[model samples]
Target: MVTSATQVLFPERIYQCEANIQLIAAHPEQGCYVVTDRTPFHPVSHIWPDHPADRGTVVLESQVHEVVDCLVGAVEQESGQLYVGADIPVKRDEPGWVFVVVHHLAESIESSVGTKATLNVDEQYQLALSRGHSGGHLSSLALNKVLHHDFWRKDASRKDELGHYDFHSYAQTESRVTEDCSTDTYRIGKTLRKRGLNAADMIAALPTIADQINQQLAAWCEAGFPVDMRREGEALTDSRYWRCDLQEGVVVEIPCGGTHVTSLAEYAALRVEFQLINEQELVMITHSQPA
Candidate 1:
């Protein structure tokens, strides 16, 4: 059964942890091992998954095992059953379930069940993904500002921190963040139209909207706004907000659960392009230049 208390080690930085490892099980068919306690690797979240897992290696008993994949694993409360990644049954932060990071080793180590092991995360890849995630957030806010004028009614309510109608959050159907950029898909269906959004007019003015977004992004990057993650607690399930300090003391806050650069100055430039995927769907692709 999954225990009530579990520890995480990635909140500060990704590195190798020299802690004792308990080999919970060995998948003979898959040639992988599962361990408990201490890992600097960040596993992909089962719910609201955006960023991918970290790649790295684990060492035990003089055997170096390449960690080909990392995933989130949960143990059952009553049945003592263990589930990994997409096989997880319940949502994250669910009560009576213990969450652990599972590092999929390339080969089985010589160590026994209770032997000590070390974990080492690939730092270069993690940094790239962090920059991409930050750029993704900035691009989304810029797009919201550019499309602010498309909302026909002032009484429709529900605007973003920048006073836009918040079409990014409201109309978005799926969002994915990659190593270089982020892709967001939105549905411009009847619900959005009923809320006083004119999709046809917005699509016709796509060029102007794109220009506006690019201009805003350029200004933000030039200003070198400070960015940080505000967390409610130190735990894995704690609520976190991505805070960006813009010009004129304006701060934008959005809920997020991912790593990012310390400041906007790290980005040399940022740009976004909009494309119409279908009659009632839109795609926004964000690009970031490394500093």
Candidate 2:
């Protein structure tokens, strides 16, 4: 069983580190699972599972082992049982469970528990995903501002970083990030309408709405806004926030547990497009290029 929460370094921009091997075991279907005292690898969150895991390699006993995948794992306090990814039964931070970052190795290493493992993440791949994640957040905020006044009622309670109605967060159904791109789907069904999103009007003005979001994105990129991931602690289960310093002293903070570039300046340009999948489904796709 895990003695404590794994010390996570990805939240603060760490991508490589030497860590002590806590446990090593072969899974029935997932190959070998390696648990470390600490890691820089960002695992796919079992709860959200939006951003993908960091792909990299682990070096031990002078041998290089490819990390095929990284995933969130938990060890039961009483049973000492380990659960990985989709097999995890309980919610995060559930009582009597210790959370861990599980590194799936293509092959088992010669070293066992108590050995030291040097972890190295694919920097280029990580950077691309960072750009996509940051762009996704900016695009969502811009979309919120563009639709706030037109569709949402004044009584709408939720607001985004720019103080517009936070329609993105409220109606968001699914989100996924890839290399320099992100696609988010939102459902504007009865609940959203009750919250004041005029479905028919929004559909009619889709083109204009897309223009507004793109313009907002252009301005933000030109300003070279700085982005950061603020964490309450270094533990794997600790809370983290994505903060971006925008124009007019506005700071946008959204609860997040994903990696992002240190600055929007990393993006040479950013933009988003809108699509209506059906009468009640809206999809926003964001694309970014690195500077």
Best by TM-score: 2
TM-score of each: 0.89, 0.95
Give Cα distance to truth, residue 131, candidate 1, Å. Answer: 1.4
Instruction: Compose the digit string of candidate 1's lDDT tens values, residues 104-215.
Output: 7776555665567787888878777778888888887888777776645544577777777788877898888787688889898988888878778888888888889899
Give, for candidate 2, the lowest lDDT window spanning 10 residues.
1-10
lDDT of 2 at 63: 86
Local error of candidate 2 at residue 198 (angstroms): 1.8
RMSD to native for every prediction?
A: 2.5, 1.6
Cα misplacement distance, residue 142 of candidate 2 (Å): 0.3
Residue 4's lDDT within candidate 1 is 38
lDDT of each: 0.76, 0.87
State the lDDT of candidate 2 residue by residue for 52-144, as single tens digits: 999999999888899999999988878767788889898777999989999999976667678888999998898899899988999998888
Q: Identify the leading candidate in terms of lDDT.
A: 2
